[model samples]
Target: MSDFATNARLATAALRDLFDPTPLQRNDHLSAQYDAEIWLKREDLAPVRSYKIRGAVNAMRKVRATNPAQQVFVCASAGNHAQGVAYACRHFGVQGTIFMPVTTPQQKIEKTRVFGGDSVDIVLTGDYFDQTLAAAQNFCTDQNAHFLSPFDDPDVIEGQASVAVEMLEQLGRAPDLVVLPVGGGGLASGVTAYMRAESPKTQFRFVEPVGGASLTAALAHDGPTTISRVNSFVDGAAVARLGVCTYDFLKWVDPAHVLLAPEDRICVTMLEMLNVEGIVLEPAGALSVDVLPELSDQIRGKAVVCVTSGGNFDFERLPEVKERAQRYSGLKKYFILRMPQRPGALREFLMMLGPDDDIARFEYLKKSARNFGSVLIGIETKSADNFRQLFDNMGKAGFSFRDITADEALAEFLV
Candidate 1:
């Protein structure tokens, strides 16, 4: 075996002291849908509810092994990475300081504290993640502590490779393809490295959120570059830039093999997994499964593995998830209706609706005209075709309306 592969196996063996390997289960639901042998490496079921713990544990363990007296470790994260680091700190009986943005949800903060127990300290600082990261790094330097990069460090990457090692051992053979969700590229790079050395013929497909496609950008630019904007809906994987260490390992990946999952479309996948498979996946965790339909043709009759990266979804976002899923599936829409400012105008508009159409939101907004007023309306229907009939009927009745569901500015402002 190659040195990297050997080290990955060693990491995997040592990880038994922390937690057992996560499940690699055959998913009949996805397998039947794509006519392939679909297996899910259930990292979501990990104690920390993510594959992040693998990297954190590996990094911390190796650091302690090399410097037995080193007891301080620090990291900055508001999500799974923070929890992972906290869990490792408690397990190894080391002191850890984790920094998170001030805006981070209370649920995440509490979870980190619960995992770390007496072994870690939680610092809430800065309004944004970048600011929080700077604070954490500065503190790390001041304390002479080991700073764990969530995905960029060599030890972290080696620790992540344990996922691939366990996969090979669990499946007893290499699969035809492995679909990985990419954030900072730590898991993808580590898995690819070990898989390439062990299962030389296996192929890979990388999935990134459309709004934060740093890996695709890095491939195009020939190096890591920060993206201009990132949509934070898929917070777990919404990374603005690929890590330099991770990008180096993933540089050989073809740009064509990387797939982008739209943020709204990912909502549909999350709902499907929850409703159909009784699996609750966060937006980032659903990335691998979200791209299955796109690869249906290529994966047919082949064995494929998808890494469902995390399940740290807050139940409070369920309503928003359903709304986005409905929008993406065309079962819901928001529009600005130019209603005549007269008696029984709403009744006339309601009369045009089909039996399956239901009004979800209705608010009258006074626009620049006195004769007519604008109504911000949200409609949900059983079928997308219901909206088509409703629109046609409204047009025939001389009622004019503008669909604002896709109008970013207007939707953000009024809807």
Candidate 2:
């Protein structure tokens, strides 16, 4: 076995001291829908509810073994990584200091604290992750504490390879295709490296949130590249820049093999997995499964494994998820309509609605004229084509309207 594979095996054995292997169960629902054998590497069932614990435990174990006196570890994370570090600290009886953004959800903060218990200290600083990371690094230097990176270290990558090791053992053979979600590229890089060494015939595909295509941008430029703007909707995988160490391993990936799943479209996938399959997935966790439809023709009748990276979704975000799914599915729309001020004008407009159309919102924007007023209206329909028919009927009736649902700038403020 290669040195990396040997180390990964050792790490997998070491992980048994914490939690057993996560399940590699075939998902019948996804398999039937996609017309292929679908298996989910359920990292969501890990001790920290994510595969991040593998990296944290592996890195910390190596550091402590080398320097037995090194009892302090530090890291910066807003979600999974923090909990992973906390859990590892408690397991190894090491002191940990975790820095997180002030805006991080209370559920994650509480979970991290619960995992670490008295072994870790939680510090809330900065509004963005970069600021928090900088603070943690500087503090580590000043205090002489070992800093644990989320995905940028070799030890961490080796630890992450344990996931693939477990997959191969559980499946008893290499899958035809392995689909993984990419953020800083730790999991994808590590898993790909392990698979390439052990099962060279396996094909790999990487998925990332479209709004935060750090891996795609890095591959396109042949190196790590930073995006000026990133949507944090997929907070777990919304990295501004790909990690340098992780990129080194993933640099050989074909750009075409990287799939960018849209943030709103991911919401639809999350909802589908939850409602239809009874699986709750965070936006990042659903990345691999979300892109399966795009790969339908290529993967038909093939054995495919999708890494469900994490399930740390907050129930509070359900409403937003539903809104984004509705918008993406064309079940919801926002428009500004010029309303007639005369009597029975409202009744006349209401009569134009199709049987499945329902008005969700109506608000007066401004007075357009002495006999007319501008109104903002939100509508939900059973089908996307319903909007076209409604617009046509409105046009024939001389009702002027502007669809604002697709207007990003205006929608941000109004919708």
For all predicted structures, in order, the TM-scores are 0.98, 0.98
Q: Write the per-residue lDDT of candidate 1 for residues 224-275, one digit (tens) a residue.
A: 9999999999999999999999999999999999999999999999999999
CA lDDT scores, all candidates in order: 0.94, 0.95
TM-score, cand. 2: 0.98
User: Cα miss at 92, model 2 (Å)?
Assistant: 0.5
All candidates: CA RMSD in angstroms? 1.0, 1.0
- Residue 247 of model 2: what lDDT? 93
lDDT of 1 at 289: 98
Candidate 1 residues lying further than 4 Å off, grouped into runs, are 367-370
- Candidate 2 segments whose C-alpha is farther than 4 A from its true place: 367-369
Give lDDT tens digits, candidate 2, residues 21-59. 999999999899889999999998898889999999999
- Weakest 10 consecutive residues of candidate 2 by summed lDDT: 363-372
